[model samples]
Target: MRFVPRPALAAIAALLLLASGCDLLSAEAEVYDSPLSADDRRAPGPSYLQMPVRQQGGAVLHTPSGTRVVRGAYDWWTRDGDLVTAAAGGLLLYGADGQDGRVKDRGLNPDQTGSTGEAISALHYSDRFRIDVFSPDLADRRTIVVPASAFDTDQASGSGAELQLHGDPYTLDGVTWVEWGVNSEDDTLTDHGLFRIEGDQIDGVLRNEPIVRLYPAYDGSALMLLRQDNGEDEDCGGCVVEQDLVELDPETGEVAAEYGMPPGYDRDWRVDAVDKVGDTVAVRFRVYDGEGRDATAQWQLWTYDGEWAEREELAGVRVWFQDGGRLVERPTDPAGSPSTSAGAYPATLTWVPGETGDLSDGEADGEVDGEVLFEPSGATCRLGRGEEFCPQLSTTGSLLPRE
Candidate 1:
């Protein structure tokens, strides 16, 4: 992405913010300090603290041993063996002694976060949109600024016009990319694009696409999910629009693969998440069975290999990502799982890296042997037992109960 001079960009951003009636910007950026207190030590409880049930927006970082949960603005917690530590806003660092600590806050808060390898990039919005790249140690590396016009928000409605960055930024093959859009409640139309960032310059690979989503592939490529306009449907009473998942090469911006929803289910299914493990790609979809007043839901996992034009759906299982391009799966109970009833799961799951070997090879044939390293639990609960090929985790109530 190419950026104008900072001085000019700042002026443009201020004008745009004023036009939109957003007064949240300060004359100067506010600094944040670490909120950790003396009493903030490891407490006796679940290894990891459960984030507030409602604060569901955040990012998950895969660690060597377990997963790190970054919740809300700055709260973060990570699991180490049988212990979990909570810290306030700052960088997260793992020590050589198997411990974690938070660096003093640098006063930087971002609207969107993305990661690639060990590098994390934060996108902060203000008068001028800025993206700050950081090292794994939280050291600032480079900053890129773009004029507000680049985002192009429409002001049709009286509500403030603003730019929105959708999903996380992705870094791969020495390049970083992010998806951004302009949304106005009054206008039904929205503009979006996937832009490639090179230093201060950004180039749009897919421009002005409607409702686009980006996911990084295991081999430095990206999967672009575009919600297609099928025009108005007078025949169906209530139908959900489907999205097309296209795999594009990051370096060349060429479509490497593409997949669409199956014929009969296109009207009532939506893509939940796209994940890659080794050479296999899994796309999760939520299918609804009826119209608005009586709809029922269930989750489906679809696996695709690069060469195979067709995809296979893994029935009745929920999958999560592991550190080394591996995926873990567990049975989903239709009667009790919230994901099957409400279209979303409350709690997120990340695998404990190095606890199990790669099951990708057998994953294609639907036969694999692996162990479940993490368990879902309340304040006090017993650990579950292992099954023939799949291990189990005990819980007081279902971690993701039906709504």
Candidate 2:
């Protein structure tokens, strides 16, 4: 903080107080030939909130060479092998047909799942296939391989033959398969085909379209499911649908094991929505729900580490600029923020007074004459002294820090 003596300013404030009855704009020009009233005054305008920025989703497992394939949701993503989905499409991304005749679609699917705010993601760890169904509104699904003991005798027969996945009578080829189940009628389709699970990625055909989701984090020893509930409107007897944030580690294929979502929310709730900078995961939620007809409080923001470890909150607050927007801050919150278009960061405020070439000497102009006086905070060191025309240099060097 800086300490500034306002003895000269006090005199001018008094003059303004007396002149307050008059139209402030019309009485400007000189104000009795003094500049005191001109200090700390702003020409009403705007808060200029963060503009609407574009959000670009990255590829699954971004490599130095560039994203091999843009990631999308399916019901599969693995060691993230580059699959040649088509012979003509540069990569499976456009569409593909492997040299050996295997065909697959490699396009991104944000809505492959049927519902809005719903995302489908896949995980291939060890030898099992993990599929994640995340709904912005409810609990997700997790399915594991049915144990050998649980395999039915009819499944052993491969009746519908979607690629029959039999754990019993070992086949000549040690490889395990999750076969497709088709009906007896040649005309009717039964189930998805059986796929031979490779190391990471899986190659399975299907009579019906199967969901596909890709990931960008390779070497991703674990698979994590991050959910952000926008607290959308809930019908009937339900209140706003509570959101949950989850992280699944496929490294061990631990089913039913993931981070629990915390309760409470407000606007400014966003994550890496715009730029991909900053290591700290930013989340803006409501801290204080002001008293009103509505329970919703103003949005507050906070940043946390993204490494999925843990950290503690340092401080927090709810602030509004009366101008337009409001900001809430919680310094150490974890990063599981929902998708939003608004920003959670603050903008810079600059104070520049006077036009260039206002200086008499061939030097930088900061002050006018001997009338130099510190503001409430002595943090700034002024230059040039004057009896009445003292200009000021904003505090930029070593000085007090702001809250």
Global lDDT of each candidate: 0.44, 0.24
For candidate 2, give the lDDT. 0.24
Of candidate 1, the 10-residue stretch with the lowest lDDT total is: 394-403
- Model 1 pairs in collision: 1-201, 1-202, 2-201, 2-202
User: What are the per-residue Cα lDDT tens digits for candidate 1 across 298-396?
Assistant: 666655543222233334345443222333343334423433333123222333233223334343344434444343444212233521111122111
lDDT by residue for model 2 over 72-113, one digit each (tens)? Answer: 221121111122111222112211111112222233122122
- What is the TM-score (0 to 1) of candidate 2? 0.23
Stretches of candidate 1 off by over 4 Å are: 1-88, 94-97, 103-105, 125-128, 149-166, 218-223, 229-239, 252-257, 276-280, 291-295, 306-313, 321-332, 335-403
Question: How does each model score on TM-score?
Answer: 0.59, 0.23
Give each model's clash number. 4, 44
